[model samples]
Target: MGPLDRIEELIAYVEAAKAVPMSRACRVDRGELIAMLEELQAELPADIRRSEVMLAERDKIISAGEKEAERIIAEGEGEHARLVSQHEITVSAEHEASRIIGEAREEAQRLRDEVDEYVDTTLANFEQFLQRAVSGVERGRDKMHALREIGTFNPPEQEESEEKPLPQF
Candidate 1:
């Protein structure tokens, strides 16, 4: 299950557990609780890794777009130079070169604009996803903290089970 789901499940488990007599703590199956916690721990790192991969991909895409834009601009400049040199050094030839250069610049600008728009849109969507993911994690964290502060569970008085150390982040 997802991190949010795991958090909700944990909350539900806590809510459904029996409350200890004369105490705020509930009696949850230690093994089950530990399992749920392990699941949650596993899920969180995957989400973080996914976000990191996406950010890296976003950077690569933006870089590629920029390189493509520069290459187009350079090609345009080269074409302009070639056209100018091929014709006799006349006013019309210079004018044609100027026109070519202008068109090249306009085309390059248009391409850059397109790339920018695409990158912005993509990044915006990714940002929204990341925001939602972060918010969900934060909410889960708050809930966990609240549960901890309240001391969610206490062992039964009659039966003492060996407590195992939980894995640390």
Candidate 2:
């Protein structure tokens, strides 16, 4: 078969020798096996050297592929980092915007509360003024009615009177 198949078969044969018990018909010569293994060792290196350039080129190709794989992985990692950073920046911007909006809503609510308080105070003041005006109008009407009954609304003449001093507390 192929060279690897032959090598495997040979290793099996060598291993099988250890399992078989020595008998009259199973005697093996160590000298022949050692001579064959020595001959194989001597020729194997020369055969391997014949293809040294091809092996070197194959190794170079494998090394280049490994480097390319590393480059691709690094690029993927960088891209992932960039996307993560961008996501963080977007989230930060959204947070800032939300904070500003919240602050504005709070300020608007506060202003609305102040306006409501002011309106309530102003309405109270107006109601008080209206009550005083109605009372004053009623007093004027009563005075007119009294004047009609007396048939006059005459005033007293001014007189020079001495002013009295009050006691201090």
Compare the candidates by TM-score and give the number of the best one: 1
Tens-digit per-residue lDDT, 31-143, candidate 1: 78778878877876776676567667656765676676666657656666776776565556567656765765676567667766766776676677656656755754565
Candidate 2: which pairs clash?
Answer: none
* lDDT at 144, model 2: 35
For model 1, name the residue pairs that clash: none
TM-score of 1: 0.57
Candidate 2 clash figure, as a count: 0
Output the number of the lDDT-best candidate.
Answer: 1
Query: Compared with the true structure, what per-residue lDDT tens digits does model 2 show for residues 1-169?
Result: 4223334434444445433233211222456544544554465455445455544654565555556555555554555555556765766555554555555456545555665565556556655644554454454345334435444434587797888888789
Model 1 residue runs over 4 Å out of place are 86-169
Every model: Cα RMSD to truth: 13.0, 59.1
The residue-level lDDT of candidate 1 at 76 comes to 59
| TM-score, per-candidate, Cα-based | 0.57, 0.35
